[model samples]
Target: MIRKIIHIDMDAFYASVEQLDFPELKGKPIAVGGGGDRGVVAAASYEARKFGVRSAMSGVLARKNCPELIFVKPRFQRYKEISQQIRTIFYEYTDYVEPLSLDEAFLDVTQNKMGNPSATLIAEEIRNKIWNQTQLTASAGISINKFLAKIASDFNKPNGQKTIKPAEILPFLESLEIKKFFGIGKKTADKMYHLGIFTGSDLKSKSQDFLEKHFGRSGLDYYHIVRGIHNSPVRPNRTIKSIGTERTFEENLSSEIFILEKLEYIVEDLSFRLKKQNVAGKTITLKIKYSDFVQQTRSHTVPYYLSDKELLLDIARNLLFQSKLKESVRLIGVSVSNLNSDQKKKPIAVQLRFDF
Candidate 1:
């Protein structure tokens, strides 16, 4: 059956929230994050984006890009409250909702509560309702599957919706740039370019075996998605695979002592996150990035689940000393994986009421 999927994404969620709460911030370039030299941007408003400011950029660089950029500290609790309110609206339409983040989600409305036959109309209604209730704008993509829906959502962004009907799927994929495909990153797209695969049509020309030899397991996914074949469902109860934190330092440090000092703080942050989520993991990983941009990781899996700060710090310290520093380190991170919450759950299949 041809499934009806809708991908909904909020426009500059964190930055927009800031603008909504503070009217004075509206129409002004704003970044939601610390303004300090060592801080990073959590989100950038559309105004700031025009100046090439973006999320994950250093505050210093963001300021350099937009001299008038106003920085506000992030309020995660307030964001979560608003996220919950938006989620409640989603639940009113369909039980099959998969949230990608606090700002974006996918919904399988093939069998909606409203008994709506046209997914396009449903997407329009949802966008209108969201704006009416929250005074926030959303963009939507409606298509036969999640892959196409996700790609479509970005076509007409900010406060618009697009529907890719069955007839348009093939031509749409053929003309699409490899970089615009959902899972293809910049590095992968570059690799594809060197292999003469610049567009979906070029990608389709390659055999599955040839793709697998280069991209390994992801090759099959690439082959299928370019043909509009993605069966991954919208799982409402997605499990948390891991929870961790990391920090990029303002200055590079060559000393192990300084790295250990940084790890202590990271351990504390990771511990707080684990405890808040009521989950623990046996595997702890130490991620190190050198001044020259080379990255490495060292991991140790304990026999039992651990979440204590002291224990995590101890493990991180051991991992740090286990290997010699390649060069002065610019970033240090600690993460917990193999989580207790990582138990596999069966995906909830959609029982289609109609076929497209």
Candidate 2:
């Protein structure tokens, strides 16, 4: 079946949002993050791209590259709001929306709510509507499958659209560089270079068994992509990231009450988030920072992710007790990771009980 998938990536999402919110920053290069020595850039506007300032770079390094660099603190709450706003636009087209980040998502519109059979038309219309409503530009890629669609979108960036038809898939893929293929990161690209697999053609020359022997499970995925035979669906079920919360005390606390209050709030938030994501975790972690500039984390992993709030809280709180902090704690945090959405279906539910 020829799946109609579209990949939409916003233009420098956080920085663009910052620029949109503040008119003065319009047309000027701006990075949305702190400008301190130890701070990092969370996002950079297109204008900042001229100076090579990018997201995840050291803030101090960015300023050195561009002396007039404008550094705005990250507003995560605002970004989350915008993400939901953009998400609504996707749901209108299709339910198979896979959000990659706050800025990018993959949509399966092969059979859409709009009854639109043309993925190209849907992508163009969505881009236009997004520009009209948010004044933000997005680039889109339309293709018969997820991997190709994702690559097509990046071909035309920042208010652009590109399409890869099923008929042209093999030749198009064969002509493309190995680095452009999905799942081949920098390290993988280097490894591929060492193996003389520089392009899709080179990848296709190898048999599936040979590819699998060299690359393991991922080699199978690469082999399929090379043959223009990718069949991964645009799953609507999204996996939530880590759950964590932190609190800064008014004054350093020696007593357990202050820590417990913060832990309670953290557990509540994580529990609510876990339920919403339809996932649970088996590991519980307690994060503590002492007044004397010291931080530590104690973690416990279990057989399964716990779906209950009280259970997570109990585990996290007990881990805190196990730590021997040399000084009073100034900050407290709790988190749960190692999630599995299939916990409900797995035998025994993988109940993980931590020993205090």
Query: Root-mean-square deviation of each candidate, in angstroms?
Result: 4.9, 11.4
Each prediction's whole-model lDDT (CA): 0.88, 0.79
Question: For every model shown, what is its TM-score relative to the native structure?
Answer: 0.81, 0.70
Candidate 2: deviation at residue 183, Å? 1.5
Model 2, 1-356: lDDT tens digits are 46688999998888888888999999898988668865557678888888999865677789988888899976766877878889899999877788766788988787789977678899999999888889899999988777888899889787899999878899999999999997798778988898899998998898889888888999889888887777667666555546776666778888787677667666765664565344678777888888987889899998976967679888988898895667988888877788875434422211111110
Which candidate number has the best TM-score?
1
TM-score of 2: 0.70
The true-versus-predicted C-alpha distance at residue 24 of model 1, in Å, is: 0.7
lDDT of 1 by residue, 218-325 (tens): 999999999999888778778878888988887999987777767776786677567545679999999999999999999999999998888998989999989678
The alpha-carbon lDDT assigned to residue 93 of candidate 1 equals: 92
Clashing pairs in 1: none
Give the runs in model 2 whose Cα sits over 4 Å from its true position.
241-298, 301-356
In angstroms, give how far residue 164 of model 2 lies from its true place: 0.5
What is candidate 1's local distance difference test score? 0.88
